[model samples]
Target: MVASQLGADGYDHTLGDFTAAAFTARAREEAGWLERLSTLEAATPDDAIDRDLVLSQLRGWVALASWPDWRRDPAVYLSAVFTSLFNPFQQRLKPEPELVAAAVSRLAEVPGVLAACRANLDPDLAAPLLVRRGLDQARTGRRFLTRTVPSMVRDPALSARLAEAAEPAARAFDELVAFLEGFACGGDWRMGERLYSTLLRERELLGYGAAELHEKGGAAWASLDERMREVARRAGGTADWRAVMESLMDDHPPTLEAMRAEYEAETRRVREFVRSRDLVTFPEGEKCLVLPSAEYTRPVAAVAHYLAPPPLTSSRTGVFFVPFTPDDFTEEEVRQRLRTNSRAQMPSIAAHETYPGHHWHLSHMAGNPRTVRKVFRTPYFSEGWALYVEKLLHEQGYFDTPATELAHLDCRVFRAARIVVDTALHCDDMSIEQAETFMATKASLTPGTARAEVSRYCAWPTQAPSYLTGALEIDRIRQAYQGSLKAFHDRIAGAGGLPLGLAERAVSRPGEGTPAG
Candidate 1:
């Protein structure tokens, strides 16, 4: 289903099978691949790195197979349905007729796929938070199928066929939502200390455990807060960072339209900054577009989203999606959103999401000759690189003003707080409400945005920590590297999205003893 949504050839016309047998079969296939990978002899350093990457990915997959998310997470099936039906239209990789046919084929399978979801899930084991999330997505998906999908088709006959298929699909979504509403909701969402630590050690190959993560994150949060206060004194002749942050929000654009235009202009500014500074080489034939988040994606994607260039397709345009206020939002709701995306913060946002951040790093990764590296990526590298560049740009005098510097530091402080909140939620018994309050107070986020961020942390354990932890690790790597700044950036980008440990090995000097797979 993921491949289909990414426009990988031959996968567009089908949906994933979510039945128990399919799960077992997929595990078996992964084990077989692991065995084959173990027998290969890597002839070069790049091949060795790819071998290690694939092995680690397969091991993680095999380990996670024991959890049986298919039996507990309904969003797995619902998201597969939404992505499968929506991507063909959004990507438009094929001719219109072919795209419609593929969508209709996948639409025809939605009822069965959703039925399999019902058969597989254990109502007693459903987490209430996740169930609520699924309900929101299902409602959005139903709207997409019934109200949004038919308008995408051009031909009248194809449009009629799409509507016919959408009727049953939308009905299936409604049924799923109804079932979720009555869920037993007894399961715990936390990964717990043991499983969370295991993912950090085995999957991310980190050196520390959950306790150390919490400790380090707490220290960083304090350090960043103190730094922000100093910067605030410089900016406003006061030592109150909170007041400075609040004041910055009042300087935002009056409307969402002006905000979008600000983002567009900011992206252009950052692109030129990178080029003039000789930061890193841009990939050939690649461009990043600033756009509004799609309607179907807005339920979960509350702030910003980066859609990477499709791996298997020829298109090299990456999209950076900024959230747009809905038509029905009240004035206060609009103000809250604009405050979160204030003009003072636009440069940092542009640097983190587009030029020299996700778009630049991913475009380079997409050009990697090794398929394994492109397929198996870690946020440790992706998000870390983006965050690392923010700091890099700051050091290079990109954000020279006191206000901009405070905004950048506040963002850093937010990532630091994420590490603490993510660890506390999973290991230290922090309640959802407590985590949201912590995020809002420490990160200076609006209440609604704080809730959105915490909700994501619950569903995705360890991911929130990756932003800060990954950036710190990359900074460590840069300290030991012997090259110009641009050379260091290019070297890491050339290694693709390897785990930072493997990336360290990839960028090592001749006598530094690169490890075998």
Candidate 2:
């Protein structure tokens, strides 16, 4: 089946076959490491040691795959694979403290691994595995600091170990930077198409193959543009949609500190509102903390994101990371942004990243009994859920203020525009310039922001469309269920939360009629 998909060109065959072979080789190489950790756990007979063993196994899988280019900027390829293969297990073990602590310790070693990745790193020999390591490090570091550290403080020894781990782990970040610089210097464009294709398949876990995704992405792009035009009309914008968007940026800019504080306050306020409104039930013994984004990741991520809660056993709490990129903007400009990304839009983002979005979804999935499914997450499902939440919040009147509504619409337009740009750049024969123009004009992105986004789509294909495609599918399912149940609120609350795989199943299920209104 994999061969058939590769076709006559054999690029897919070579890449896919080599990757599979590599996966086998990596598993074998890590066996001894795993065994050693298991031995350590059995011999030491302490919760912390045992937990460390488990984390070692996870990190070992990540470290063994670390390659130079893969380590530097791995959002596209490596992230997809790790999320698919490891997230499920990570989720399952999230509730356990010993395991969470062990995971944190393992993650703390990432910076060291990056430091170890040097300039002489071979792309042919190193590219395939490098990212896996960096991702593992980043993932582990994020999991430990964001999820495990806060809760596990109850254990003095464990707390001390975690505190000690941060410095070395942070030092590892320099290695990461060194490895990335090497990658930028030596990496070729030849692997771009192959890497992009592999990422799309792995992340979506769809049977349609790479070519199909590209084709669908192209088609969706056109469809979404038409939709956005209608939205623009509704907003009474005719003086070039891009101009209208830029105006918004200018109209509402805020100071960096102010922006950060506003976002922080808004997130808390939204969570409180959700709880008070009986929108959803948040579990006990769990908390949320918002921090500044790390240097390495701040380049591409949005202003903020939700780091999933640590496993139940770990002392970690979930984190909402918001980078303080003050250097990137002036004080006045930053202040304008504070008002721009105000209470209205902030709540929806919070909803998407926390509460009923990624954090909540992942937390639940991690706790589910299906261990295999827990480990294997589909980006389509996960990303789709967050995108769906954005619209859901808007629909549920979370964006009650006009400014907030505009903010929500702004995001929606941005997403709608993504479908177009993501598809055109990859499959529709659009140039980088064309893609950039489309984003700037249709999505209302600034020149700088639009250019960055275009680079991202070019580097990683089919990801942008996932927001729109996934949201559409989720909304469709919700509508279908509402039709059958007739009571919208009751139906949503009663249906329980849908896991990624199950959501796909429900969407793909034959003879599934649209929800009856």
Estimate TM-scores for all models.
0.94, 0.62
C-alpha positional error of residue 99 in candidate 2 after TM-score superposition, expressed in Å: 12
User: What tens-digit string does per-residue lDDT give for candidate 1 at 72-100?
Assistant: 78788987887677657766677888888
Candidate that would win on TM-score? 1
| lDDT for 158 (candidate 2) | 58
> Cα RMSD (Å) between model 1 and the true structure?
3.0
lDDT for 244 in candidate 1 is 85
TM-score of 2: 0.62
lDDT of 1 at 402: 96
> Across residues 171-259, which tens digit of lDDT does each residue of candidate 2 receive?
55444544554453334222233434544443343445445655554565556555545544544455234444444455532555565
What C-alpha lDDT values do all the predictions have? 0.82, 0.49
Superposed model 1: Cα runs more than 4 Å off: 35-41, 153-160, 325-329, 509-517
